[model samples]
Target: MAEKLPALAFGELTDVVRFLMEIDKLKSIQRRTKVLGTDRQENTAEHSWHFAVAVMALAPYAGDQVDIFKVLKMAVIHDIVEIDAGDVLVYDLVARQAIHSEEEAAAIRLFGMLPDAQGKEFHHLWHEYEAGESAEAQFALMIDRLMPVLMNLHNQGQSWVENGIRLEQVLSRNAFIADVYPALWDHLKNHLDKAHQSGWLK
Candidate 1:
């Protein structure tokens, strides 16, 4: 037999439910990377879920001991702001900088929908990811940046080709991955070399 769980107070339940409903909007926010083996673009919600899974899978490769739970939380909440700011290409320096304020505003507004304690936790996790200072944040950020590259690799550099992205650009943008996980960076660079030689990248 299972133990019965305590129920939440009515107000708390309402706030939690409203926050859940609000974050559902994240699914509608499309990203530049297409889903593997599909023509359709992935959504922010899908990316978050995938990121969390990748975090779990890649946790062993992290350079230092990390709180897997904290990293997973960071992955899940990091992009909820995209529900308002929309997805920007990782390679787009100008557009990425332009939306910094909008993304921060979106983060505050969306996370503010939750009750205070829960909201603060979400905000902290999101900001930690943005800062990328801690070991967990670095691991999480590495995976976050790696996923689209993986997607592009599997899909024959679809986004890179479409965006006219050069091999140098991809390397420059994602070189920080080496600081977190050099082995992963080496493996990725090898594939990227093949990709460039195959003429998938400009």
Candidate 2:
């Protein structure tokens, strides 16, 4: 008799389908740069990649002996929910909070699309980033703060000026970075002060 092929498990097949579907969602995030004179939108995948690299490059300064690997994983996938929830600008505090549950729902729907194990792994990571608990969370949050700061500085605070973002608000929002990563904070603060002096923070 000819050899017979083993049957595939339904759960495994479901996982494969889930993974394939989730990959497509990565392209949905879009961010516009008012500061850089560029109106082009950036996808979530690109933003995650940049933040991941930022985490690696700045890992040496992480707070409380962070695990670089965990931090990397967290950065790489933190904003995936934006694929569904959309990128809420940091300056829009009221809108940002209003969408918190919306983003959580997005997280559940998107992360649940993966294989069971992988789905849980990513879901946990997303929750960790949200909770801001571990050293990894702290560092991930710092990088989250840093990328926009650098982008704004490079573009002469275009986003801030366009949105009428105030210096006090910006300072308060970003100050948590100092607690987790002082060196990064120092660098950002210097630029911020310059932006203020240059009439970028009116």
Candidate 3:
């Protein structure tokens, strides 16, 4: 017979479970970026998972002052607000500003579903990621920005072409990555040059 799992009392565990169930809605939140090697658009959940993994891999490059634990936490919770605000394109400056309040409201509601201390930690980490001021936050943001660029390059700039995004726009939006990770930015620029030459980016 299979081992039976123990039941939990209705308290902190229940709150955590409820929060987990609620965040499951993130899987249904679609993004404009397609999954590389396929035409299907990737969802926020997949993006978060991929981001967390990328953080683990790139933590060594984020400098000695950066906290990997905080970076990882920020990665996982950064997009939970999108469960309510939905995914906005990073390049959409106006749309991003317009949704700031909406995203904050969503963060409050979703993170509040947890027990007080846990909720506060998540909320703080989420805000830290958004602020992008701390070393850890900057590192997290760099990887966050890098992922889509890498995906677009691999997928032949599918989303960029479809959205009429220009090379200058992409470079301008992601230029901050150079400040955070110049080596990686240099590597990405090479691929971007090829993409531009191939007319994948206008």
Candidate 4:
């Protein structure tokens, strides 16, 4: 007779399936943007993918030795909490203040869906991204801050103009990234200053 595996055996395969399904929900959480014209509605999945690619593209500028894979995972899971908190505009001061509590609650609920070990692992990754302590997390954040700026610039400040966003607000929102990725920040600031001068930024 074949030996039994165990009374309370849990298959890692099942845990993977559950995590995949939960991650799939990211495809439905749309962001507030009108990029690429026709009022583009980007979902969380797209945003995550964009950041992951950007992290690699900008990796050399990271402050310390960074594991590209960790940065990718960080980017992919960083905003999963936004599914519950909802997408808040970068320039919205009131919404930004409430984001912490709302996202913490959402993180508990969303991450709680996974098997114990898996949930804890992902929660740690998400928290690391938020803390911006690791080199990977810092790089991940730079991309996160850069994406909207790229969108606005590419679309000739379409979203910025619509949202009544000023250059000062955009600069302030991304200022933290300068602490780790000063080169990227410098590049962005140059573009932003030109954009402001040319009436491309409001």
Off by over 4 Å in 3: 1-9
Residue-by-residue lDDT tens digits, candidate 2, 1-202 = 9999864446658666755666677776666444256766567677788799998898767644799999998987788788778888887889899999988998888878776788899999999999998888988988887787787788877778777777888889999988886776787878888899998897
lDDT of 4 at 15: 59
Weakest 10 consecutive residues of candidate 4 by summed lDDT: 6-15
lDDT of 3 at 97: 100
TM-score of 2: 0.85
Error of 3 at 132 (Å): 0.6
Clashing pairs in 4: none
Model 1 TM-score, 2 decimals: 0.93
Clashes of each: 0, 0, 0, 0
- Error (Å) of candidate 2 at residue 145 is 0.9
* TM-scores of all predicted structures: 0.93, 0.85, 0.93, 0.85
Q: Top model by TM-score, which number? A: 3
What does the lDDT read for residue 120 in candidate 4? 89
Backbone clash total for model 3 is 0
Q: Which has the better TM-score: candidate 1, or candidate 4?
A: 1
Q: Roughly what TM-score does model 3 have, to 2 decimal places? A: 0.93
Global Cα lDDT for candidate 4: 0.81
lDDT of each: 0.90, 0.80, 0.90, 0.81
**Each model's Cα RMSD:** 6.2, 6.0, 4.5, 6.2
Please rank every candidate by lDDT, starting with the best: 3, 1, 4, 2
